[model samples]
Target chain A: MLKELDPLLHSQLRLGVMSILMSVESAEFTFLKEKTNSTAGNLSVQLDKLSEAGYITIEKSFNGKKPLTTCRINRKGMKAFEDYVNALKDYIKK
Target chain B: MESENKNLSPEQSLDLIASMIRQTQGNVSSGSFYFLLWGWVITLCNFGMYILAKFYSPSNAAFIWTLTIPAWIITMIYASRQDKTRSITTHLDKISMWLWIALGITILPSWIFGSVIDWRVNALVLMPVGMATFVSGIIIRFKPLLFGGITFWIAGTLCFIVSPLDQYLIGGVAMIFGYLLPGYMLRSKK
Candidate 1:
């Protein structure tokens, strides 16, 4: 059974972003930027795409005058991850 | 079954994920709280060693007794098996769990080699260990693990600074700060 996923999360960068977010309570923008090895512009674009898909929630705050962005994956995101993994496994199984 | 799947709002999604993580992680290390409760016993013994060493030749018996890497490893294994189901939440739990593991690994070698190697080198052990934990935290974006790793690195810093002239103090500090506090947090998360 295939679980339909938001198109936004399907791309490799977005997928990596979601995977990283799924593994933590929350993460800062700087941290995520470094982890995914994506430039700020690209990561910010992917994150906005994820947020738009309702797969994640983003909070913008300032840490000592510097902008701080933190993100957490939502329930839909979690299920999507499971469903996505399952779908991937299905392909492997075939 | 198809109807069971529905689009969730971000808040709802996060709630579901959080619950899944908790359900799967389901009390890592059954006796962790109890062991942590008794962690003070180790602290007390470490203190007793410090006191005794001040008055006598460096204490070996108590120093040897405080080696905890094996116990830490056993505890880690026990904790990891607590969750079998793989989910996004469970995956994150695995990340934090590995934080504790890397912390253990950081100090383990120091304890094993402290006697044979220069005590000065024992202090250096924290750099790689701390860096590993810190980088993992950054990569995974796990703040709690980051906090734990910071604590380990700070404790490691202390050990590195003082191990040359003082070993038991470092042990005592590591017992209280490194092991006891993080263990409490890991168990207390409900």
Candidate 2:
């Protein structure tokens, strides 16, 4: 029996965001947009969804008068990402 | 890049994760600036102190080290600029930063108390530096820095056996091998 793929992480942008977050301590909103090649609006929406699901934390602050957004993967998100990768491996191995 | 909302197959998802990891790996910025800057500065200070003590006067020669005040100020400015420009901070980067900061804090007490007690503090300073370099190398998995750290330890040991003034020469050589050489290597790799 195969594990179910995480619906929240199955999409390209969300998966990309999580992958990037997993590799770093944290990343700025601009960085995610650039790395994922998603429009600002689309990236914001996906980030909000991930934040709502407790997969990531979004911090909004100011960097020298400019509004800054930073995203970090929480422990729950890390576990989910790991489980997702294992499930994906199970599917690919067959 | 694929469309944001599109569903990905398992293989595609794995590939995406692998690629993103590679991208982050390559994003490690150059650390050569700090290494080269401090390497040259300390090397020059050591040699300058040696020459001054040999010829003119040993009384005020240590004052040459005061130049480090300006060097550190410039380093701070350079570091702030780099931080502003950088897009991501990896776990390794954070660890390296804190390790060096801890090293700096250790140096303060060594300097103040060593001078008061009239103790030779070269070994005292160099040991922490070696530990910092070694740990940073382990964090980044960089062989040159790992070797550089060992070089510092060896030089520190030699300082105990050599005459007081010769420690300056040994330290200068150590900076060349331990910091400048590895610094250039890191720059080229970057």
Candidate 1 per-residue lDDT over residues B56-96, each given as its tens digit: 66645445345444555655565554332212233444555
Collision count of model 2: 0
DockQ of model 2, rounded to 2 decimals: 0.60
**Tens digit per residue, CA lDDT, model 2, B63-114:** 8788788889988998887776567888788777888889999998866686
Task: For candidate 1, give the lDDT.
Answer: 0.58
Shift of residue B25 alpha carbon in model 2, Å: 1.6
> TM-score of the candidate numbered 1?
0.43
* Candidate of highest DockQ: 2
As a TM-score, model 2 comes out at 0.84
> Please, what are the lDDT tens digits per residue for candidate 2 over residues A1-94?
9989999999998999999999998888999888888899988989999999999999887757878888999999999999999999999987
Alpha-carbon RMSD, candidate 2: 2.9
DockQ of each: 0.04, 0.60
* Segments in model 1 whose C-alpha atoms lie over 4 Å from true places: A1-94, B2-48, B57-59, B66-70, B73-77, B84-89, B102-107, B119-122, B125-151, B163-167, B185-189
Could you tell me how far off, in angstroms, the CA of residue B160 lies in candidate 2 after the best superposition?
1.2
Q: Assess the local accuracy of residue B180 in candidate 2 as a C-alpha lDDT between 0 and 100.
A: 91
